[model samples]
Target: MIAYVGDFGLARFLSDVPQTSLVGVKGSTGYIALEYAMGAKASTQGDVYSYGILLLEMIPGKGPTDDMFKDNLSLRHFAKLSLPKRVMDIVDPVLLEEAKVSQGSGNHTNTRKRMHACLISMVRIGVLCSANSPRDRMEMKDVVTEMHAIKDLYLGVRIHQDEQVMSQLSGEDPSYLSYY
Candidate 1:
């Protein structure tokens, strides 16, 4: 099922057509950008900020409005703090479990390292996209490119690993496996 994480009132009232600007700042509290709060008209940059927050939330499974985001701490801050250091600590338990299951009993270290690297890259994109200054934020096109690259990086490793496993089971050379 698809779930939305924005202003319910706007979603309920507004037409399905794309909107460039709204009458006023009307977004979910935590998802709204600082410029919007300061009376800046809604813009694509603002939307990018919100999308960044979504990415950050998705990986860690923590909403910006969660109780832990009090007293100057925010979803952005939480994610930024984790960085390349404590990514596993902030990542969702479900993702970790899924990784473990998919990894099976072979080459745990390599699978885990790849996972960590991908997680770091994802978090960095989110952080860049949600920068306080609109100019500093990553463009939507760039975000898309980065996301696809990360996906390819992870899946490329998985496909190679799967081919190796299949070859071992069938007593065939891994190099002779057909990628097509």
Candidate 2:
């Protein structure tokens, strides 16, 4: 239930007197798509575009800035090109470290393989969500579903690891959770 809290028309109205609904152009610059800024009617598609931008923000932990996109090097453009590997280059360093730890240190080749697969899936989703064209982007419903699937998969792995840890604590299998 992520929500955008900014200068959208609806937010403006909420700030106004007794249930006033603001009527006019709505959106924040830079974050909003070019079409919306050009007086195109706001619709679910527009919201999708904004959501894409929001997704980019979440990954990078920073709003899109003019300097970040010099001559078409913008996140949107980069993502649309399916350059998730390159995108990974700009991800927050903290996140990179966490991802590395999550995908490493497993003797069971299958477990390491699954972790790598999940990490790649997540990177692909982030890239797709930030595509340049609205039509080229994934629907919010699809995005939500994909996110849930990834989360569930990761959680399942964590639960399995935890169970093995408990088993080892009970001396049932001392090496059950060993990653070496």
Candidate 3:
């Protein structure tokens, strides 16, 4: 029995050697950035775009190459079109059910509304990270910050940033942003 206690990420990350620009089609088709397909240099933005796709896939339970996508349809577009409103329609049923089971008992409608707000924020992050232009995508630090905020909101546990709990909290009647 052998146990590898650490992550052995691809050696490409360790090797600081400059990769040849315009390398032909290096990554999986769906995850690869459009700029890469057009023979541009590999970049951090490309990785961010792929991560966005991955996040959307987990939420929606849809593969990038799912057959439902045709006539210029794409996983990105499918998710984008469902954002803010119609979001629950596309969320993974099992995940939604689990959410309903956990921390959902106090006023069903409000609970669902809170959950929807959290999910909408997450989807917006995904969409921002996967924008068609590399310049439009989020930087990794911003991504981490936003994700942590979302996590704090979802858990109902305050993550004190500057001694302030930063959930959609304003005044009385705690408002989840989705209600607006």
Tens-digit lDDT string for candidate 3 (1-180): 122112122123523545455453355657777776665566678778887777777778776777988899888888878765677789989888778788745766545555676687777777777889999888878989978877776676552441233233322224433322
Global Cα lDDT for candidate 3: 0.66
Candidate 3's C-alpha runs over 4 A off are 1-25, 104-107, 159-180
List residue ranges in candidate 2 displaced over 4 A. Answer: 1-23, 80-84, 98-119, 157-180
lDDT digits (tens) for residues 121-157 of candidate 2: 4545555555555576667788788667656555564
Q: Candidate 3, residue 167: CA error in Å?
A: 11
lDDT of 1 by residue, 1-180 (tens): 122567423333444445555454577767877775555555677778888888898888888898999999999989988865687789989878987887678777666766776787788778877889888888889889868866765565456554444333222442311210
Worst 10 residues of 2 by lDDT: 14-23
RMSD of 1: 9.9
- Our tally of clashes for model 1 stands at 0
TM-score of each: 0.74, 0.58, 0.74
Please count the clashing residue pairs in each candidate, in the order shown: 0, 0, 0
TM-score of 3: 0.74
Lowest-sum lDDT 10-residue window in model 3:
1-10
Error at 22, model 3, angstroms:
6.4
